[model samples]
Target: MYGFIWRHLPGNPWVKALISVVLVLAAVYVLFQYVFPWAEPLLPFNDVTVNDQ
Candidate 1:
């Protein structure tokens, strides 16, 4: 899959590397800014409890 993307990206190695970094950053930004926030409330990570036995 990654090989397919690398082949489709325009320009030589340097340009391709730059574009790859940018695409990764954009994906991370979207996940953190939108996806994670939307899914957070649905997850059980915050449902913590402690017993003093």
Candidate 2:
């Protein structure tokens, strides 16, 4: 799969690197901006809050 993807991408190393980075950023943007915000409220995590009451 990695070989196929690399082969389809740009031949130049610099151009391939740029495309890889852009692809990653695009995925992250879609995940964090669209999915994570909605999923975070539904999923639970430990909240550590220190309060002097």
Candidate 3:
């Protein structure tokens, strides 16, 4: 798991940071890209509503 990787790659601080950042970004990308798209139709937005007069 993460502990094993952390122990084995203890000497590479840069690699650890890069991997952590990539993993965090990937999770965010997946949430916004896939999960948000699925709910897009359920939400609503109006650039010009009745009050726009």
Best by TM-score: 1
Q: Estimate each model's TM-score.
A: 0.90, 0.67, 0.51
Candidate 3's error at 10, in angstroms?
A: 6.0
TM-score comparison, 1 vs 3, better candidate = 1
lDDT-based ranking: 1, 2, 3
Tens-digit per-residue lDDT, 1-53, candidate 2:
86787789976988988898898999999999999989897875756587999
Task: Compose the digit string of candidate 1's lDDT tens values, residues 1-53.
Answer: 99999999999999999999999999999999999999999999978999999
Write model 3 residue lDDT over 1-53, tens digit each, in one string: 97886667644889887887887899999999999899887778544457655
- What is the C-alpha local distance difference test score of each model? 0.99, 0.86, 0.80
Q: Which ten residues in a row have the lowest lDDT in candidate 3?
A: 44-53
Off by over 4 Å in 3: 1-11, 46-53
State how far residue 35 of model 1 sits from its true place (Å): 0.4
Q: Report residue 46 deviation for candidate 2 (angstroms).
A: 6.3
Model 1 residue 1 CA deviation (Å) reads 0.8
Question: Which pairs clash in the backbone of model 1?
Answer: none
